[model samples]
Target chain A: MNLLFILNKPPYSSDIGKESLDMALAHATFDDTVSLLFTGQGVWQLKTDQFAKLAGLKEFTRLYTGLDLYDIDQLFVSENALDTEQLTRDQLMVEASVLNDEAISRLINQQDRVFCL
Target chain B: MTTRFSILVTGSPFTSQAHHSAQCFVDALYSKGHQVTSVFLYGDGSYVANQLMHPANDESHPHQHWRELAQKHGFKLQACVSAAAKRGILSREDSELSGKSSFNVTSPYEIAGLGAWVEAVANSDKSLHFS
Candidate 1:
């Protein structure tokens, strides 16, 4: 199944985003085709050089670095989200392709299931 | 014709309407002769599984709605064990493992891994998320 996970919350300060990533990994481990879409402030999760330790929390964003290990290779980030944060693709921690609204709609249309977290 | 459904709850039990509203929706589905294969409580939504909740007699809280509905409909009510743990909702095994004095996960509501939700998703005709 083509399962897609849409994460709209930013990293740190909450466990919602972390659970979404873990659930995505679990789906992949079950042999389902899983993908991730980072939208809204969630795009901040892909920014490089996070200092979660400063917030007294573990750097859970590091999990994205190993998403590929679980066969979850498809990752996308919203263009407006990055622009709103004044971030560029080069500033992202991983190699997620920036997606505009039209592209995002297409991506959603192709998925058998899309989970918005 | 849709028959089997898989529900995901992602909102806080008391603070959010996910549980209460979802209970109504589940009943509506059953009224239409549909089957709920499973209801997976996740994120802050796991707070509903904390059966230790005690509301005053004059009012009702969101706990046990799923437990009762699942019993009537013969469906499974499960929660992500890790998420439930983070919110202080523990299963018997977890309570024992962590040496906690008590466990609050109510009967008919099981704490499970996310793989169980995945299985529900794969087996159901459709999946719905309440937040």
Candidate 2:
């Protein structure tokens, strides 16, 4: 199945971000076709140099670096979200293609399953 | 082709609108003659299956809606076992295995693993999630 996980929450602030990543990883582990689209506050999850340790939280963002090992390389980020957050592609911890609203919609339509968190 | 849907709910019943939205979506699917193959509750969404839930009469009872919908439509209503275990929501079998005298989840809502969710996603024509 073509599964697309749309993450819209900020990392570490709530469990949503971590849970969404876990769900994606779980699907990928089972050899399902899984993709991730980071939008809205979810873009913050990919921010470079996260200091979750200061907040006494484990750095879950580190998992994103290993996603490629699970064959979950179809990562995307919303261009508007990145711009709104004043972040650039260079600031992200992993490489992801930038997608505009139209592209994101197309991606969602193309997926057999969509899980928004 | 008839669209077979698999719905995923990951939000808490009390805190988020996910349960309400999921209920509405299922109702619409039924009205449109679409088949809802499964409804999988993950994360805090397992709370929606709690049989002990007793909301005030005036407020909307989303859990009851889920129960009724499952009964009426014969769709599988499942919750992630691990997630439900952590949240104190257990089926009768789970309660017995854990040596608990009481169970909070009842008919139409079964406890399963993430593998069940994966299967639902793979078998369904489209899967929608509310969180």
Candidate 3:
């Protein structure tokens, strides 16, 4: 299935986003195609310097690098959302392409199934 | 067309992408001729149906937008009753019977269970989760 996941929460503060990311990883590991779109506070999860002990949450930032191992490489962040949050790609731990709201909207409309976390 | 849905709105009216996304989905669904049968407002998303909300001069309240949309389009706005009651939002009768101070939920919207959300998924052609 062509699955799309829109993550809204920061990686460090909430278990929901983490669980959903784990689910995405699991699905991709099982040979499913998964695309990830980060918007709002969710863009914060991809930032650099995110360690488990400092954030007091399980560290999954490393998974961003390992996603290629599972073939779930379509990672994108909304440019407007990133700018609104004052985040830059240089601050992200993983390589992510920036998307405008129009692109994000189109992606959402095209997905076979979308899971937002 | 087939109805596709299952939504999650965690942000409150003050700061959240949930309301915007939900509205966009509604417009998109309608334009595409799909249907939205049930919307699940969990965590802070439950505030969409709060009847007592009156925004002051400062905030661009998303609650008002949701309220207007729900009223205008006949969308089913559901707040998790457990969360609603815990947060001191209930129907008038619920407030009187339970002895609560605030009544947060009323008509146009209803308090429901997670099973209802599951039922929506099962019955729909597809499920779209809005986080």
Candidate 4:
């Protein structure tokens, strides 16, 4: 089944943001086709130079690099969110397809299950 | 068509509206003669079955409400074991293994693994996430 996870929280501030990714990873490890869509403040989760240790949080952004091993390579980011945050693709740790509002709508429409993490 | 829904809740009881919305949705499904395979709690939602959460006498008790609903509908309420462990929601076995003196998991609420979650989803027609 195709599952889409919509992440909306910034990294480090909320523990759910990390546990939500862990859940997604668990699903992906089960061989399910999973996609991750980062929107709003969630886009910060993909930043390459993240040092969550300073905030007393585990550094997990680099885990995205290993997602492909679990066959979970469908990573997407909201173009509007990135622009709103003045972020560029160069700041991201892993490659992601930047999606517009319409594309995101279509992506969500095609999913069997969509969860807002 | 009787839809079998499997619910995933990721919000806390008192601080978030996710639980309230999920309960009402489950009620609507029950009213329509639909079935629920299971309600799986993850993230902060794992606190739903803390067993130690005793709200004010006049306030609605979320844990009791869910337990009663599960009993009435004959659906299992499962929380991810990993999630529960992270939040200090330990079972009797886990509490003992961890050298803790207290345990919180009660009847009708099972602290299980992701395999249980997958089975719950597989048994259902659709999975709805309330966060």
Q: Residues B1-131, candidate 1, lDDT per residue (tens digit)?
A: 66899999999877888888899999999999988878999999988898888888776667766777988988899989989997899988999999999998867999999999999999988889999
Q: Give the residue spans of candidate 3 off by over 4 A.
A: A1-117, B57-59
Tell me the tens digit of each residue's lDDT in model 4 across B51-127: 99998999988898899899988888999998999889988888899999899998899988887777777788999
Best by TM-score: 1
Which of candidates 1 and 3 is the stronger one according to TM-score? 1
Clashing pairs in 4: none
Model 4 share of native interface contacts: 0.47
List the per-model TM-score of the A chain. 0.96, 0.97, 0.92, 0.96
**Candidate 4 docking DockQ:** 0.60
lDDT of 3 by residue, A2-102 (tens): 77888888776655676567656755655557899999999888888876876555687677878888898899999998899999899888888899989
Residue-wise C-alpha lDDT for candidate 2, range A1-117, written one tens digit per residue: 788998898998777787778778878888899999999989999999999999999899999999889999999999999999999999999999999999999999998777886
Query: What C-alpha lDDT do the candidate models reach, one value each?
Result: 0.89, 0.89, 0.72, 0.88
lDDT string, candidate 3, B47-103, tens digits? 666877787868666667666667866667777665566566687777878977757
TM-score of chain B of each: 0.94, 0.96, 0.81, 0.95
CAPRI-style quality class for the chain A–B interface of candidate 4: medium
Cα RMSD for candidates in order: 1.1, 2.7, 8.3, 1.4
Give candidate 2 misplaced runs (Cα > 4 Å). A100-106, B92-103
Residue pairs with colliding backbones in model 2 are none
